[model samples]
Target: MPVVLQAGSFGRIRLIYVLVQYVDETPKFGHTAVDSSSGTPILNSSAAGVSPPTPAFTPSHYSHIYGSTPETLTTIDAPKNYGHAPWPRISPREACLLRYFIEELSRWFDLTDPHNNFATSIPQRARSNPILLDAILAASARHFSTLPSDQKAHIMSHYGLSPLPSHIHDSNSELSITEETVIHYHSRCIAELRVLANEPHAVMDEDLLAAVVVLRFFEELDNPFTSPPTETALHGLHVFLRAQASSALLVPGPRQASFWIGFRQEFNLAFSQQRNTNLPLEITDSYLIFTGAEDHVWTNRLVVLGARVLEFSYGSSPSNDLEFNELVRLRDEWVDKRPRSFAPIYTESPDMDTAFPKIWYTDDSHITAAQTLLLINILLLAYSPSIPRIGPSRRQTLESIDAQIRTIVLEICGMALSNRQSRPAGLTACIAINLCADRFTDPQEQRALMGLVVGTTRDSNYWPTKEAERRLRGIWGWDGDDD
Candidate 1:
C-alpha cells in the first residue's frame, strides 16, 4: 500500500524529513490516492458513548515522513482511511484573493521574495477545499490592510497592483483596515475550523495547516495598548490547530515545509503571552534547523531558550542551577561558533547618507539574526537577576548582572538602528529595551530607545512597537503625547 500523510492522529510533525518537489506551474499533483494499508490506529470519538480521553501530549517527539516513531505522541479521533471532504463553496471574490496570496503574498512570506517560493501546496489546495481557500483570503485581506499603501504597489506588483478589486484606499492613501473588515474576514477564515473538527485528518492538510498558521500570524496585528493578542486571543482555536500540526510529519509539499520551520515564531509568541497560556504544542529537536542557514539554526536555538525563559518566569517549570548553566553554555556556544560570514558587519561609509551599517549580521538573514540576538538578550536578562544559586558569590553576581545587562541593552538598542524598514521582529528588541530601562539612572539612553520604538511604530505600523512604547511611557510617567 502506498503511504499517505495521516494528520488525524495528533502526531508529531518531523523537523527532519524528505522534501517533496511540487511539479511546475499548472502541474498535475503526482501522488496517488490514499490507499492505506496498516497505519496508526484510529481513535473512537467516544469510548462506550462518552467523550474520548484527552490524549497525553508528547512534545519531545517530532513528525517524520518515513518513520512512525513520533506517532506515539497523541491520539485524536480520526476519519476512516482515504476519507473525502465536503468541499464547501467560498466566494469567487475570496477565491481570487487566495490566488493573490499564492501569487503575491507567498512571495513575502517564506516566498523569500522574488527568488524563492515556499508553501507550494498553497496553490494546489484551492479547488480541493474551502477551509484553505477561506484561510488564504482572510489572511490576504488582513495583510493588505496592514501594508502601507505606498509599499503595497511595489511589494505586490507581480500581479499589477493597479485597479485590483482587493485594493481599498483610505484618507492618506494607505491600505485601510477597518475593525469591521477584520471581523468579517477573520470570521470567514475561522469558520473553517468547525469543518475540521470532525475530520481530524482535514486539520492536518498542508493547505489547511498553512491557513491556520497564517491566521495566527494575523493575531499580532493590533493597537498594542488596548488590543492584546487578537490573533492569538482565541485560546481554543490556536490549541486545536497546533495539536493537529504536531501530528503532521510534513505538510503536502516541500515548499510548505519552510512555513512549518518558521512556525517557532508564532509558537513562541503564543506561549510567551503575559496571561501564561499553557503549552499549546511541543517543540521538537528536529525544528532546530528550520533553515539550512546558520543564522536560522542559531535563531531556532534562541527560540527554544525563550520558551524556557517564559516557562521559568511563570513558575510552570523549576529554575535550577543545571538549567541556568545550560542556558549560559548555549549563549557562549552560539558566540564561539559564529561563522566568519555571520561576523557582525559594521560599515561606517564616509558617505553622509548612511546612518547605520550597510549590513548587520549578514545579507538576507538579518531579521532572523537580529531576532536571535534579541531572544538571547531577553533570555539572559530574564535569568540575570534571579540566579537560582548557580555557582556564585552573591555580591559579585549582582555586579556582573548589572554589567551584562548594560551591554545587552546597548546591543539591543543598536539593533533598532538596523531596523530601517521596521520589521515586526524589531518589536522584540524594543520590548527588551523597555524592560531594561529602569536599570539606568540616566534617562537619556532610555529616552533614545523610546524614540526608536516610537519611530518604528509609525514607520512599520507593526502594533507591538506601540506596546513597547506605551510601556516605556508608563515607566517614565510621561503625559498625554498620544500623537
Candidate 2:
C-alpha cells in the first residue's frame, strides 16, 4: 500500500506498507450512505456485532512510523482517578436532557477520544459539580432544542415521559425551547463561576476547566461562525485558560482532554476572522512533543500544528524564510511519521453521482486525525509565502496552488461524508467548506458542496453549519432557493 500526501504533485511522499485486504463489514459507527449531490441520507441503520479488530502490525512496522526504537515508545498511563461525588437531584425534565447528553450529545465532544470520558467521566464529575452540571445541561438543552418534533419525541420516549416546563412552550402549544430556557442553565453556570473565579486555585481545578469547555460549545451554538468576538460575555474563558496555563494544570487526563477541545474551539474562531488565537503555545507545545503513545496524543499533535499554521498566517510579526520553512517541515514530518492506524481501511474513487471520493477510517480518532491533516495542508497552501512570480510564471503558480487546495478540500469532504456516523466529522466538513467553497466554479460541484453543508446542518442540528451555509451561498452568489 502506498499513502498519497496531498501537499502538491512534486510534494507527494509515498509510504510503502503491507496492503490489508478490504473486508465488506459493518463500519464501527454503523453506516449512513449519503446522496452526494443532495447530502440526503439514503440509508441509516446499525449493524449487530462489532467490527473485527484491526490487523496487528509488528513492532518493527510501528517503529518505522514513530521514527524511534520500539523501546522508546511511551505508553500513555494516565490514571482514571475520577473519584466518586454525590449525585445531584434534579427534576424529571432535566433528567431527560442529562440522558440525552450521555446517549447522543457527548459524542460531539468525544469524537476523537476512544475512551469517551465526556460521556463517562464528565457526567460523573458533574454529579457533584453544579457548575459542570449546569454547563452540560445547557449544552444538552440547546442541542435538544434543535431536534425536530418527532425526533425529540423519539428521544424523549426512551427516557420516561416527563412534564414539559410551562415556560418552555411557545404560543403554538407544541413543545419548544425558549432562548431563555437555555440561558437559564447557562446563566446559572456563569453566575456560580463568578463566585469560584475569586478563589486563587479555581483555574487549577480540572472540573472548572471542563465546565468552561462545555460552555464554549454552548457559546458556539449561540454565535456560530461569528467574528473574533470582542464584546462577548464569555470573555472569562480566555482568562481561565491563560491563568490555567501558568498554573501548570494541563497534565494528561480530563484537563488535557479539555485543553484539546478548547484549542480546536479557539482555532475555529481564529481561522474564521483571520485573527490569532489567544491560546498559549508554550503550554500546548508541552502536549505536542509526540512522546506519548495514545491515539489522542497523535491527534493532538495535528491539532497543535493547526495552531502554529494560524499563528504564522495572522501573527503581527513579519514573516521570515526561517519561520515559513519550519512550518512546512513540521507539516511534512507529521504526514510522514503518522502511525499505521491512521491509514484508511478502505478507498473508492468518486462515481458519477458523487463530487468527492470515499475514503473510510476505522474510528473517530483516525477520522479526526486524517481530517485535521487535510486542514493543515489547506492552511499551508492558502497562506504560503512563496516569492512573487510574473506573467506566465505567476499564472502557473496560481493554478498549481488552486489544484493542491481543491485536492485537499475534496479529501476533507470525502472523510467527513464517509464517516457521517461521527458528528464532528460533518462539522469539520463545514469548516472546510467555509474556507474554500468559493474555489469551485462548477455548478454541480458547488451544489454537492452546498448539499453537504446544508445536509450536515440539518442532520446534526449543529447551528454552526447553518451559518456556514449562509456564508457559502453568499460567496457563490447563490439565491436562497437555489440548489
Candidate 3:
C-alpha cells in the first residue's frame, strides 16, 4: 500500500515504504562505477522495477509552493543512448524560448570556460534529457518575462513565440504565457527532481547537476524584490554538490562546469549578504592551479584568488597581517607570471565624452580577469586593517585608500562600458560599483556610474538593476523620485 500526497494540477507524489532485509545492498543496476566525465548512462529513477540501494549522501529537505509532478514534458524514454534519438516535437513558444536560451542565456554559464559547454553541449543534451530541458525552458521563460515590453514583442515575433491563448493574460498583467510557461516547466522539473532525490545514484548524474545549476539561475532572475527569497533551489544545489563530492571524483565535464557556475552564484550571494560563502575553499584550491594552463584557466585562477580576497574581507576569521601579506604576494605573483594574452589590446585615456579611461581586451576572458583583479584590489584596500599613525599620516592613509578605490571603480566602469557584449565583465563591474559607488561624489561621475549599472540590466535583461539603483540613491542621499 502507498500513501499519496496530492496538491493541484501539478499531480501527486506516492511514497511507498519497502521493508528490505539487507542494508548494504548494491544498486540493482549492474556494472562497476566509472568516471562520468565522458559520455555515461543517465539512470532513469522514474522507471519501474529499479530499486536502488540507499545512497551515502541524502538530499536535503526541498520545500516549494508548487507540489507534485505535471504531465511528462517529453516522450523520450530514459536510460537510452543519448544523442541517438530524434528531438521531441516542441511548440512554437518552446522553440522561441530555446532560441532565446542559446543566443542570450547560454553566454552567462559559459563565461569562464572558453569551450562554452552550456552554449554547445548542454542544449544538445537537453533534447534527450527531460529534466535538463525543463530547467532550460523554465529559465528561458523567466528571462523572457523580464524583458522590456517593446523588446518582448519584437523577440516574440522574431522567434515565433506566439499563438498563445487570449485568456492567458490575467489581472496580474505580467502573468502572460511567459510567466505561466515558467511555472509550467519549473513545477514539472521540481516534481521530477523530487522523485530523483529519493534515489541516491541519481545525484551523480552530470546532466542532473547541470539542470539544478540552470534552475539556480532561474531563481536568481525570479528574485528582484518582487518575490520572496526561496532558497530551495540553492539548497538543492548544496545537496547535489555534496553528494557528488562525497561519492564521485569531480571530473572535467558538466559536473566541473556546474561547480564553477555554482561558485559564481555563491560568490554573488556572499558578497551581497556580507557573509562567507558556504562552499569549501579546499575544493576550489584543487582546481585552477595555474601551472601552464590556457588563458581561460589562468582567468579562473584569478577567480579563485578573488574568492580568497572575499573571504578575507567578510569571513569570521580575524584579519591578520600574515594572511594579508600572503594575499598581496599572490596577487603580485599572478600579475607577474600571467601570460601576455592578459595584456590589454588597447588603452585610451578618458576623453571629453567619457569620464573613465577606455580599456579593451582581445578576448572576453582577459577583460573578465581584469575586472576581477580590480575588484580584488578594491576589497584589499578598503578592508585593510588600520595601523597606528600620527594625525597627518592618518589623513594621508585615508586619502590613499580613497584614491585607489576610485581608480579601480573607474577602470571597472571603463571595462564594462567598452566591452558591452561581455555580460560577465558587466556583472563584475556591478559588484565593484555596489561596493564603491559612494566614493564618487561628483554629479557627473555619479551619473556615469549609474549609467553602467542601469545599462547592464538593460543589456543583459536577466540581472535586475532597479533595486541596486535604489540602494545607490539611498547611499548618496538623492531624492527617490529621480532616476
1-483 per-residue lDDT for model 2 (tens digits): 121111111012111111132222222224544322123332222332223344544455556677864564445333333444323334444567788888898887886666788888888777667678878988988988877777776666666564354336542222334454565556555545544534665666778778877877876776666444733323445655665664433345676667667777777677766677778787766644555466777887788788888888888752666887887887777777778788899999988888899999877888888888887787777677773546667777877888888778888889888988887888777777777876888788888888888887688888556566677788889886876
Q: What's the true lDDT of residue 131 in model 1?
A: 46
Q: Local distance difference test, per candidate?
A: 0.48, 0.67, 0.67
Worst 10 residues of 1 by lDDT: 31-40
On residues 1-483, what C-alpha lDDT tens digit does candidate 1 reach at each position? 111111122223221111122121211122222101112122211221233344443433333543554453446433223434322332333434555566655643551222233336555655555445545656677666666656555554544444333454442121233343444445534433443445545534555555555655555544342344442323433443455544543432432343443455444453345333344335345543333444444554555555555555555454565766666776666656655565657733223332223335444345555555655565556555466465557667766777677666656555556645435445555555655666654455556667777776566555556556666778777789742
Cα distance off (Å), candidate 1, residue 366: 5.2
TM-score, model 2 to reference? 0.76
Clashes of each: 8, 0, 0
lDDT of 3 by residue, 219-250 (tens): 77756422333445666566556556533224
**TM-score for each predicted model, relative to the true structure:** 0.62, 0.76, 0.75
Q: What is the lDDT of residue 226 in candidate 3?
A: 25
Clashing pairs in 2: none
What is residue 31's positional error in candidate 3, in angstroms? 28
